[model samples]
Target: MPVAAVALVAGAVGAGPVIAAVQGDPALPERTAEQLLADAVRAARSDPRPMSGTLMQTSSFGIPGLPQVSGAGGSSPGALLAGSHELKVWYGGADRIRLALPGRMSETDLVVDGDRVWLWESGTNTATRITAGREDLAGHGRAPGDRAAEALPTAATPQQIAREVLERADADTAISVTGDEKVAGRDAYQLTLAPKDEASLVREIRLALDGETLVPLRIQVYAEGSAEPAFEVGFTTVTFSPPAPENFAFTPPPGAKVQEKALADLVPGPVGGQEKGEELADGAEVVGEGWTAVAVLPFSEKDLRGLASQKGQGAGSADAGAAEAAVESLLKSAERVDGAWGGGRIVRTKLVSALLTDDGRLLVGAVTPERLVEVAGQK
Candidate 1:
């Protein structure tokens, strides 16, 4: 299984033992920071064993007046940015995986079975099928519904988050072995990474690596001057047993609206046409490196409206209106600021700063507002 194929899963039967393990601290031999870091990197790159587990993610960014749009429940993409969420995952390999986000009365599932991928939303009775060609299967080629899959809250996982943080680790990052810790009732070693730059809003990031397998079981990211984690994702219960073959089989619910998409449709055409990948590459650029890096992208009002409309379709008109209103409230709450680069509105949260320029450029990063303005001036 590829590293990207690795994610967390859930079952009450599997949760019992894990819950018992969390009660007492497990004793383990001490290891150096370098040893633990190397083990984590190796595990991430290596083929992972078949597993199933449940993951929980919590966020406390402290963005005031955050809207609670109707229909945006635990399965909604917007819900991932705030509050708490639980996800169940089953990973057989890179070619077979299932992620389920259970809501009070509805459930959303993303299943990749061989070359066919299915996204099922019980709330809306919608099923989207993405067919990947043999050539595209290895890389998981993008299709029209790729954006919809990207919106799934299951996209965030402990292994995924740990991989990204490890990629950003450099000389500017101070790495150390904090101590041994328990996660999901498993003995693990805790590794901490702290950025050297003062301008970055991130104070430190911590990862709990399983003792034997070295798979990341939990990750916590803290903002500068804050003791609580701004964002966190971790497995609560896990098992190494392979999921049943039946778990990968899916037949959309009867009467559900189904849409089919092909990879060829994602290809660009002639006459100034471009694919989504190319458009994003050409329109966005990253400034700086490591912790203080800022991403600059072109985002106009039209684009925002399109996003709102897309959310509305998945949800409903009333919820869509609330979404639009939320966007308006966010813009209104932003402070007007003028910099040497230009004038625009800036929004600051505990761990993120975003500047929407008058010229329709959006610069965002986990850095100080001053850092965002500095990067905007460079543009």
Candidate 2:
């Protein structure tokens, strides 16, 4: 399986051991950072092993009032790194993956087998399924009603996050090996990447690579001008043996609802619901690249109304009014501003900045608010 495939499983279904092993100081052999990173890529490409582990996540920055607008919480990567959470995982290849999140009353699970995926809420005895080619039942990057997609646990896996940063490293990034550290009872190389661009909101990104397998053990992201990391994700306890096949199998209860959906329906819709740039973005413009990039999306009338309609639950319903009001409340935190791209509210956080136009469009990026506004005009 591709490394990216494993990442999808980790992000949506987190896991690791709950108990920490006795701490030990282990000295690691000297190796160039490039060698370590290359080994990581090799490990990802070489073999797909069955691994089970414990994991956790937390976050601080979110859109003040409008939760969705922040796009930081829920099954989002942001949420995976914010707050407190713990989970367990079992992975066996393309045909099988299992996640167990313990709750106060029961456990929630996501299981994948071959062409179908299942989400079971043990507490409610309910299950949802997404069959192959079932577009209507899925959404970009996740399945409907899947808590991992709707909201992430408080944690991420280093293999998932570090791989992405390594692949994107280039002239815009300053990469270096910063010695070694112990993670999950293993001595690992520490690789760090700092953005060369001053406009980038991120100050640095660090990854710990397992010395033997080359898989990443931990990943951390730091904000500009901050001494500490804003977010982190990693495994606590893990094993390399393959998990049992039965872990991926699922059967709904007698009274449970098993709605089946085609996978094709889950793709992201074209931006503005138009077909010109199906690949550009789901509904936004990507300006620049690497760490300095910005996304300018039109979030005006049609988009807002579409969101309102869903949350509203129907046409001419109180839910719609409530949704609209909620949106207004979220946008209220933005400061009023007028510019070449017209007027909109600007919202800033430690690592992200965005503009919400009076007319409804939004300009967002990790860079300065001025950079987003500049990109907005060009768009």
Candidate 3:
């Protein structure tokens, strides 16, 4: 699995959450949904005390053949353990984990002086250079999780709700206080913010605010077409001060397989040609349970880059070419069943990743070869 995950990082896009729906109850508020939302934002920002904490986040989903584990069968869990004093975050995914810390951004005496971001892998023996953005690691490097958490306090926060997606609220939003609940053992108020339309990516944001400071203990985001809960974040052992000086250095173990190229530079580009058979007519209907198969012909090639699931994954730098190959293999493997296309009944054929990328894309709505033939012959 680790091998596959490494392969996927070279090819797939990242992941995010499904926003919830915003059906406002009449008892919600008179200030309008957006207004109430603004109030909540103000309350969050008013929290002057900076905070640092460790966050353990987990998510899971069902897969075709793999036995169910956590969250759901196919879903996977991700975690971020961060400390404020050092401005570092330890990120853990299903197959891999890494630690990151502030660099040139802080006012410290360290001589390793931040010129580049650094990364180290346990499986590999060396540290690699990473691109630190212009503003990143400049003052007090902003951890990605920090940025995400900070955005939560701003009304400008973007979210997805069901079929609707709200980018930035332009005062047209409304907000109000609802009830209260216990979050991680803290007394909290329930605040709801609603967007104006059903299309709003965030239907309603239900928050559990700390009663005394109004710091959010938890937040619930609703979106369309997602049964899964909207994303949630929490902090523990949090401190608002700068982290220790020694926290930001990346010392790869001896003999690490250190690569000098930027991540993008190392990745291969597009492969696979658009042959007559390879190119599906525009609007041609192709369906499969495997996200990869559905990805190449019917969906844009770009989508293949972001593929993730429980099956095949993590085939490092070789993924793009591999994906093209996989597309061809899938196309040839598919048979027609009474006018419908189907692959074999391993459910969706388990993806065979040569190098392993992240989870290979799940092929959905696929049919078996015999079934496909039967269906195509009839029509």
Strongest candidate by lDDT: 1
Candidate 1 matches the true fold with a TM-score of 0.84
What are the per-residue Cα lDDT tens digits for candidate 1 across 1-379?
0111111111000111112124245477778888878777878867767899998766666564464322224674445554566788898876778888877788888887776678788888889786655555343343322222343533577877787777667788899984548788788888899989998888888888888888888877777887677666789998888999888889987899999865344232222234433533558876877788777889866676678777676477887887677677777888898977779888887777788888998888788899988888888
Window of ten residues with lowest summed lDDT in model 1? 9-18
What is the descending lDDT order?
Answer: 1, 2, 3
Give stretches of model 1 more than 4 Å off.
Answer: 1-26, 68-72, 140-154, 263-280
Whichever of 1 and 2 has more TM-score, that candidate is 1
Better candidate by lDDT, 2 or 3: 2
**Order the candidates by TM-score, highest first — what do you get?**
1, 2, 3
Error of 1 at 375 (Å): 1.4
**Cα-based RMSD of the predictions, in order?**
6.2, 6.7, 13.4
Give model 2's clash tally.
34
Supply the TM-score for candidate 2: 0.75
Compared with the true structure, all predictions reach lDDT values of 0.69, 0.59, 0.33
**Model 3 stretches astray by more than 4 angstroms:** 1-50, 59-113, 131-167, 170-174, 178-189, 199-203, 208-217, 223-230, 263-379
